[model samples]
Target chain A: MPQGQPLTVPNDGLTTKARRNAPLLAVHTGPGKGKSTAAFGMALRAWNQGFDIAVFQFVKSAKWKVGEESAFRELGKLHDEHGVGGPVQWHKMGSGWSWTRKQGSEVDHAETARDGWAEISRRIAEERHDFYVLDEFTYPLKWGWISVHEVVEVLGNRGGNQHVVITGRDAPQELIEAADLVTEMTKVKHPMDAGRKGQRGIEW
Target chain B: MPQGQPLTVPNDGLTTKARRNAPLLAVHTGPGKGKSTAAFGMALRAWNQGFDIAVFQFVKSAKWKVGEESAFRELGKLHDEHGVGGPVQWHKMGSGWSWTRKQGSEVDHAETARDGWAEISRRIAEERHDFYVLDEFTYPLKWGWISVHEVVEVLGNRGGNQHVVITGRDAPQELIEAADLVTEMTKVKHPMDAGRKGQRGIEW
Candidate 1:
C-alpha cells in the first residue's frame, strides 16, 4: 500500500483463487542464477506434500554434479527406506540418453531432443508425475531441436492437476505465452563482473 | 557455440575461481516469485557441505509454515541425531520480532526492523554462521526501516568466509551496488493473471 493509493478490485480476476485449480506451466528463464534452484525448491515443497516428483535436465552435463541433484537423490532414498515422502525421479542431460560432441552430429542431437520432448509430452498426457521440473529445457527449444509449437499444444491440453516448471535462458515466446507463470532472472551485478569464480558446496 | 562463431575467452573472471573467499553480499530482488525459495536452496547446499546455516525471514507471516523452513528444520534435527550434515537455525519475521498490524506504530515497526538487522549485523561481524539467508530483507531496507548505508558498509568490511544472501522485491540501489551478486526476478506472467489463488504446499 503506497501513499494515497486507491486499490480497486479487478472484476476480471482477483487472485481471490487460482484459475480453476488447473495445472500450472511455469518457466524460469534468464542470465541470472537460481532458476533451477527455485524449481528444485518447488520440487522439495511438492515432495513434502506427498507429490511424486520428476526432474529432467536438458543442458547441464552429467559430469557436473549439482547439489540439488544430490539432495533430491538422498530424499528419494529416504522415501524408499522410511516412507517419508513420495517417489522421485531425476534424469540429467547425459543420464538416460544424450548427444555429446564425440557421439553425434547436430542433426542427431536434434532428433534426441525431439525424442525427449515426445516422452515428456506423453508423461504429461498420462499424468506421470505430480510435479515436473524441466530444468534447462530452453536450449533444445531455442536450437530448433524441438518444436515450441508442439510443446505449447501438448502442455495446454495435458489435462491434470500436475505442475510443470521449465528453466533456462531464451525461453521461446510461444512457451511463455502458454505458461501460467514465467520468471525472467535479470542480472544487475555479479561477482564474475568483478573477477570471481564459483566455489564448491556453494555452486553445486 | 553459435553458428560458425569463434569462441573467445573473456578477459573478465570466468568464475574460474572466487575471491580469497571473502564474505559474499548477495541480493535476490524483483517482482517475481522464488527470491526467498532460491536463497533457501542455497542454504540447503551449505547445510549439505557441513556449513552452519542461519535463515532469518523478514516478511512471510508467522502463521505461514514455509516448506523450506520445515525441510531445513528436519535437516537440523538429523544433524543433531545422526550428524548428517550441519546445524541449522531458522527465524521468521514474527518468530524473533514482528510488525503485525495489531502490534504497534509504523515507527515501532521501523525500530523493530532496525533491531532485527542489528542482530544480524552483529552475527555477521562475529561469523556466527557459515552461510546466512536473510529472506525478504530488502523490504525493510526499501521501507526505510533499516539504513542501507549501514548494511552496505558492514557487509563491505565484514571479513570472513561466510556467505550472505538477501532477498525481496525492490532492493535499494546502494545495497545492490555493494552486493557481490544481485539478481532481479522479472515477472513475465503469473497465475493471478488468470484469477488464481495461492495453492496449498505451492504458495507455502
Candidate 2:
C-alpha cells in the first residue's frame, strides 16, 4: 500500500461514516493470462458472502472445462444440499447457447453473441444475481457484435446491489471509462515466449 | 491474443514433443487489484492438479482473512477426509513470523521481512511444495529488506517441478527479467475514485 502513492480518496477525506456501499462495475482486460481467473476469484469471494452468482462464459469452447467452473458448480450444489449459500448458475457459449447453432459461421457467431448480450441485458434489468461474471466478454464487444455503447449504458444503469465483472483483453474505451474498477493485465514475460506450451490444469 | 502482436515463440515452435514441463517462476506485480488474487486462482488450478500447495502471504495482516484462505483450508481438509486433492499450507507474516516480535519498528520490520525471505529460500532448496505462492512478496524486496540478487539466484537454481508465484506492486526489474511469466496489473479505474470504499467480500 505504501510502495507507490497511496490511492487518492474521491473526496478530500472519506471516513467510514461517509463510505457508501454501491454496486461495482469491474473490468479485467489484458493480454496476460488470468483476467477471467481473477474475475472468478471475485466470484468465489462473493459466493462465500452468500451472493447469488451467475457466470456467462462468452468464448470458451464447450469442450474446455476450467477448474473454476467445476468448483463453482459444486458450491452451487452445496447450496441445494446444505442450504449453506446462495445459488450458482453457469452458462457457456457452446452448451447453454445455440444462437450460432451447431455449425457456426461468422454471421451466426455474431448473431449468437448479440443474443447472449440481450439475455444479459434482461438479467441486469431483473437484477437476477448479486454477482455476474462475464468471462471473455470483451471479445463480442470488441468484435462489434454487441454495441459497446449499449452494453455500457445497461451496466451503468443496472439497479440494486448487483456487482458485474467483465473479463478479456482489449476492453472498449467506453466500457473502461464506465467501470468503477478496471485492471489491465500487462504481460511482462511468459513461458510461452520460451517456446513452451501451456500445461493442462495450469493453463485451461 | 490477436489484438496486439501475437506473442513470440521462444523458438520456431514449441510442440508437446519438446515441451519441457519445467517449473515456472511467475510474478504478478502492479498497483491494480488482483495480482495476488490471480496467483491464488493459479494456486487453485494447481491444487486441482493434485499438486501440494503452499501459500506464504507477506503483507496481509493476520486479522485480515482473505476468502481464499478459508477456501484453500477447506480443500486441504478434504484431502484428509476424502483424499480429494493435495495438502495446503498458508503462512502469514503476523502469526508464523516473530522476527519483529509483535511490536513492529521500521528496523524490526525489515529484519522480519528478511527472515521470511530466508525461510522461503530454504523451502525452494528443499523443494518443499509443488506450488509456492509468495503473496505480496515484492514488498520486502522493494523495501530493501531482502537482497534481490540472492532471491534471483536461489529461485533460478531451485530443483524439481516446483512452481513459484510472487505478487506485489513495483516489483524489481531483476525479478521481472528472471521470471518465466510476469504480469503487471495496470489500473484503469477504482471505486475509491468515486468516493466509495471497498466492500467486505469484494475487497478481501
The candidates' DockQ values read 0.40, 0.44
The true-versus-predicted C-alpha distance at residue A179 of model 1, in Å, is 0.4
Model 1 RMSD to the real structure? Answer: 5.1
lDDT of 1 by residue, B49-98 (tens): 77899988776355443677777777787688778778999876563353
Q: Judged by lDDT, which candidate is best?
A: 2
Which residue pairs collide, candidate 2? A195-B10
Backbone clashes under 3 angstroms, per model: 7, 1
List candidate 1 stretches off by more than 4 Å: A1-20, A63-65, A95-108, B1-20, B63-65, B95-107
lDDT of 2 at A151: 94
Model 2 stretches astray by more than 4 angstroms: A1-19, A63-65, A83-86, A95-107, B1-20, B63-65, B98-107
Q: Write the per-residue lDDT of candidate 2 for residues B1-204, one digit (tens) a residue.
A: 322123554555655544646678899888988887788788777777778998888874664446777767766765666676578998777644643355444346676677788888888889889999998889889888889999999999999889899998899999999998888888877777665766756775
